[model samples]
Target: MKSIKTKHRIIKAVSALTALVLASGMLAGCGGSSDKDSEGRTIISVGSWPPEESDALTAMNERKARFEEANPDVVIEPDEWAFDRQTFYAKAAGGQLPTVYLSGFTEMPEIINSGYSSDITEALKNNGLEGMFNENIMDIISRDGKIYAFPTMSYVLGLAYNVDAFEAAGLMKEDGTPMQPANWDEMVDFAVKIKEATGKPGIVLPTADRSGGWIFSAIAWSFGVEFMEKGEDGKWQAKFDSPEAAQALQFIKDLKWKYDLLPASTIINAEDWYRSFAVGDGAMTVVAGDYPRRVAKYGMTPDQSGIMAIPAGPAKHVTLLGGEVMCIKNDATPDQIDASVRWLKTRYNNELTDEYKTNTETTTENAKKDGQLVGIQSLSPWSDKAESLVWYRDYIEQNANCNLNHVKLYNDFVADCPAEIKPEEPVC
Candidate 1:
């Protein structure tokens, strides 16, 4: 696994200073009341980065309208802001951060330790959602038994393959089920067969950006390698300079050079990789479970898409855990904080309410209308396996446009594999 550096250096320095100033201001009752509009409605801004004409943007707008209707005292504000390492400090220091924003799970520890996030322990308890979160996820955003953020969604990295390509390559069992490789050698063989059968790259790898390192880490972890580890002195150190790590990198190199199974353009990122895979230009790619929606947008049907656990390595099978955590800004007023919690609960926790049911139906219908993927399988942030399956069973059976069978292999793996948190970047 490759060690990824901290994406934003300024976050570590500025957040602590900002927190101190805000904490002092709070004692003077000076920082909390500035978030109200002239109409006296509490303004709650949400951060997102959907393109103007995208289905994601449309869905976000619809959700905002529903949230406002349910809470008359609050006004929803949409900020077309995406998290970028270069610009995050500027936005945060300039008081431009939205009341609620999406942050990567990898960033939560630093964000929490720096005091940039609001402590939402009380809020979760007050809303009766304290015990509902998946413990593995909650542990990432919590410190000293206090949670600073909400787990919005979590996903495991897996092999997303073209079902048609697999079948054409005769990579299916006698019963007509896709064959899942148990180790790297089998995976390589399958890739070669698929590429020979279909004149396309056997697999697409992200090698141009940090995602390259991210994906590499999952592959290495499966081979029992860690990018960094805490030492006996209680300080983190890089451990990737080892034989196991070398073997992992060599495997990727072999896929490109030795096996000739990868594309000549080796610098593709997520967008480019998705474009190729969705259009049937590649046999498979390692991606998160949330990729189905993007696949759908590219005109791939559920039957054409298949997902499975990342093939096991010599040591064990593992998948990388990734997701977004919802956070409130540090300087938000108590009223704003309360409002944020209520909004989260309305969206995630009140699944049994009529309002939520109506919203779900509307969302499903709109997704169908927009040709978006509905009921894609993913890790639930709010419930355990048994509860999550039961909680969304009706919605899945009724509105899913994708073939659930394509995702069954992944679902079964997640049901048993113990999820490990992404490794924190090593500090020099």
Candidate 2:
């Protein structure tokens, strides 16, 4: 029996909206190039790749085109850089910076420290898109209580299963959807039943060290890690060594030892882990914000594969919040910031622009057919539709899941990575 207990606590979106409005006035005008012309184009550079074939790179190029179409006078240039967490700052330095660009939410500190990006308060105000992002995440990017970035994805970490694997394991739902196990015990039972039925490992256990760390953090959090809380001294305290964290770590240790259902080589790298998934080593695996689309391309369509959140635990049902956020350059001139806002609002809220937006990037815009969980708390769009870019407003109206809270606690996890691995090359 999956005995994990989960209680959901969602932060109110109203508070976020309230904060955003108040925040816009704080950084009313950014300082940047004063040039202004209806015919003038602000060169917005982005990290992109080409000539060398890469799926992710292709996706970026497709979106770049759509942005140009929507803002006829803006030139969105490719700010090519390695996708590693390190190189982004280097690119941000060379003055090769775009008026605006995408970046990781947690990494905002680096940007703030460097003073490369514009403070987005005014742009967010002009478009009325402020504070709509996950509140906690907004807190993460904020310094001295001012907003700097716009959170875009509301992703929930969940299981993505192989339909063929399920059929082979006799685990399909009566509705013919692939079985998506909900909590931990159910997950283990399903894994065992499948392996017994098919002689293959039941869960691949995403062995890549850092990736596994991501899953492990969610598990520990679901198991109840009292992360980031005001300490007795009233400072943010790190709690990775807590009992709950240890238990979570032990659970992972058990999966590797007692479960005996995962292949060692599989844990070596993320690509290898996905390959095991593609070959149907199990009925299910932990899929991140981007992997469901990869699963769809594996053999069956996304609908056929079926998806659901991570297993519940005794403490809380939480998924490690991951993905990117778009922030403003703190140094950008007021005019440049406004121009960027015009483009951002069109892309962020414009209803008619999504399909064109998704199509250009080749991200799967239609992953929400079974619908999505767009928690105002979690903020970033749950877009596994790597090739789809339908307007987010339409998505939010139809499939938004209301319970997501961008739990500030889960942000401290550092992948306990092994030394043998190397990061894959960036697409752009």
Candidate 3:
């Protein structure tokens, strides 16, 4: 998860009318510009939302500087415009989109169908990156043989838990390691033990908005439920109303209503829940691989936390894969589109070139200097499974900042998990 800090302060609740006015003001200011600068260089904006003092923000600035040096005719504009559901469409319709914007893999179909993204098939082919992407992920941005965006990163849902709390609860094995639960029942039992022993909430399950549904889909899929399935006619239809889905929902409801495994609030968004977990308020929660970076910002050390694969269900284990895609605005000129693609390749997709190796080395060295974790395992969008594994091996060997044993369970799980990986829901 990307860390975007928000300040908390006590204030009187706003009246309904005032709230509406505030919302209107927010929507009214969603526009951005893409005109040439005084120097006559085409301005190509990129979207990022890194915390002020984070290594990520520093890396992004460095990349922007390098991009500008390489493409002097184009000026790189750094926009702090992270993806927001409420303002996205308004910005797109107003021609205020950054030249390159980040979007969830699940949002591509809707963005493409709504004519918000440019067709980048020819651009990718021209750059020889058409065949570089993992086919499974490429399909997320491709429709009828036209590509709309480039997949930048991919992730799977997993169980993030506090090691100290688990040990206090005697949830660890005799070998001084976490006790890996094999199924949903064992997981619930373990959560109960952690709560009884630590006097803290057993687990936090986000039940608020789209995130609740997203995490629930992972559980539902693990329960052998396919929320949406392709019919014989090749059209997608909702299948979430099945018994398996009911079982999954019941499990979550039991955590809150019956088991009292969650907090009293009963509804928590992703950021709030992650904060709760980071501060050691809860023992476990569902999260992606990059969650540790967020936890670190909250003062949690690497040894204090660990991640494991989602527990197996009655049928088998499955994980829902999701990630971000880099897209160009539909209104971009041909030159702007080419420059955007070139920027993307230089920054993210240069893995096959010698420049990429040098870049990787430099990034690892810099991360070491900045005290950043170098080799946290994550799914790749540009390479197939085999190639990704090879890349990861070399990367960890040269760049790992933490002990691999800290997340050994997660590593083992990813290595042994079934190949039947499921993608996010296709219906936008």
Clashes of each: 0, 40, 0
Scored against the true structure, residue 344 in model 3 reaches a CA lDDT of 88
The segments of candidate 2 whose C-alpha lies over 4 angstroms from its true place after superposition are 1-78, 82-84, 88-96, 109-116, 128-145, 167-170, 177-182, 226-238, 264-266, 296-304, 347-349, 353-428
CA displacement after TM-score superposition, residue 166 of candidate 3 (Å): 3.4
Give model 3's TM-score versus the native structure. Answer: 0.74
lDDT against the true structure, per candidate, is: 0.75, 0.53, 0.75
lDDT of 3 by residue, 1-428 (tens): 11112111111122344466677785343334345677878778888646487878888888788778988988887788888777787667656678899999888877887788999889887977768876657678888989999888888777888888898898866554577777778888988999889888888878878878888777877777877777899667887778887887888889878988887787798877877887778888888877866666667765677777778787668787899999999999887888889898887753555666666678667655543445556666765533434765677755566655556677666655553567788772
List candidate 1 stretches off by more than 4 Å: 1-43, 49-69, 72-80, 90-96, 174-176, 230-237, 365-375, 385-389, 401-403, 418-428
| lDDT per residue as tens, model 1, 78-194 | 778877756665666545678988888887776776567898888878877767887667678888989899887788787888888898899865553578877789888898999
Best by TM-score: 1
> How far is 322's C-alpha from truth in model 1 (Å)?
0.7
Candidate 3 local Cα displacement, residue 414, angstroms: 3.6
Task: Answer with 1 or 3, whichever has the higher TM-score.
Answer: 1
lDDT ranking from best candidate downward? 3, 1, 2
